[model samples]
Target: MSLSSKVRTLKELPLYLPRRFSAAQRQRNRRNAARPPAQGIVVGLLAQVCGRLVKAGEEALRIPERLPPSAQRVQEELKSRGYPHRVVETEETTRSAEEAARAVGCGVGQIVKSLVFRGRDSGRPILILASGANRVDVAKIGKLAGEPVEKPDAKFVREHTGFAIGGVPPVGHPERLQTYIDEDLMRYGEVWAAGGTPNHVFRLAPNELADMTGGKVAVTK
Candidate 1:
């Protein structure tokens, strides 16, 4: 009989003479018949694993390293004034002068504390950039401001400077402030100042600080 006539279906596909076929040849034919299904399963599993890996990589790439809005404002202000330094965020809080010094790895005196005071009579905002190691004499500040000065509440600081009390930067206030710089800060070559948040800061030369804020240097100890 013809080969096509004998093997009408896939199940019947075998050597033409089954009685003459060796045991090894029959076993090999069975294995070959099973191969397509097994190969398909392995290929499908590999495709799933590869697809999962690709999805994981795409998710990781979507993460961003953008700065906070407050910090970005400070950076823009610095850039506008042709300032060379960039603002940096620290893991530790730089809310206080001592804390800022610790966070920046500098001496307490190298920290510039931006203190906001209100003119008692004019109701205007006065900014004092004092050294961390020094305390502001209200009477001295009042003399420079041409009016009695008093420390204002947090609300006043935020309204006038557009920043919280602890994070007030020397520049970037909503309005131009009558500013005074502590003469003592002139002793340091480089000083740290609050950027725009409690954990943010920037470094600049003491003279650059004076030139940037246009604040008159005087005795504020």
Candidate 2:
């Protein structure tokens, strides 16, 4: 191990490279480090969108939680029957079919105009759940009831149905009346019904309403 031998061995060794990236490679690394990964960015955006959607849904649910007592009862009744539709209360009145359509932003045919009629012979109430756009023929409804039908006054309506003329529903009557359904009402996929008050209404599918009311669908012509 002489000094000259050590010097010759060191001179035969390979040259050393610096422990640093080139200028171009260093610039590329800096660019990559400056921004988040594509996958992480996408996942963060998706999380934000999902959070917004959940918040919107919660707000919608809360908006309908302020229904009036009468409307609340209707809401409860519908939920009890497995219909989870919300009761929407409007500032405008929905007493008439036209008014209801305008207030609900739906067609007149989409409103369920509940009517109470007196059976001339049996003296029992005959409920006709007709389409708002329909003019129910008393003769046709009478034929369905098997007795002459007369439009009952508001007093009779309240006494029999436990609701006012503008807020009558197929159910929630003092006594279950024989109800006839207007076939035209079944045409609409969805219909708006009074929720125990004129200003309160609820969206209901025609089939579900028919089932809930236990009424026979027939042509009211």
Candidate 3:
């Protein structure tokens, strides 16, 4: 029989059972009659517990459709520029290139690493969009920029890019920065970039990235 039917039968057992009341059996019959109410109470409690667990599972599966504030800015920028890409936010952290690749289920080479550097002589910010699988050559970038470049602190990165180190995007900076695109990144048809937050990202064509940032394609690695 079905589980519900079984519970129903158990609940009605006290009422349906044959009753016997002889002089010697009277006390034993009374004790037997008292058990069904306790069993019914237990069944009711089990049903309530099962219902609450189902409710909790449903609630855990629901994720908010709205984007975070930082991600929203990136989305708005793409919209204003007439790009069709949408920012995707996830529960997993994509702060590192490896983590980002894992989160998006893409090869590391397909992830764009937005790196910011300080021009040694001019004290200006330089933006380099490199492939995640490639290591940038600072000397080569210095020659291309006409000055040696130095790694900047977290404060310098935030001041220039209007975002944090790990979550910087190619566009939406406070001001236009001298940008460079890694030639290695050009090999990928599509690439993923940070969307202004550690847990946010967006995908786009390599050519579209060059157009959006207006960065010169050069040998960065």
The top-ranked prediction according to TM-score is: 3
Task: Between candidates 2 and 3, name the one with more favorable lDDT.
Answer: 3
Candidate 2 lDDT, 21-131, residue by residue in tens: 345654553344232111100000000000111111211112343676666777788778877666655555766655554443334444556667788888888877765
lDDT of 3 by residue, 50-137 (tens): 0111111211111226787777888899999998776655445666554554443344444566777788999998888776656778
RMSD of 3: 24.4
Off by over 4 Å in 3: 1-64
Model 1, runs deviating above 4 Å:
1-64
* lDDT per residue (tens digit) for residues 1-221 in model 1: 33244334323222111122244643443343221111000000000010111111221111114567887898899989988666655556766644544443334444566777788899898888776556667788888888887767778888888887667777888888787787877875555566777766666677887888889999976
- TM-score attained by model 1: 0.68
Q: What ordering of candidates by lDDT runs from best to worst?
A: 3, 1, 2
Misplaced by over 4 Å in model 2 are 1-65
Each model's lDDT comes to 0.59, 0.56, 0.60
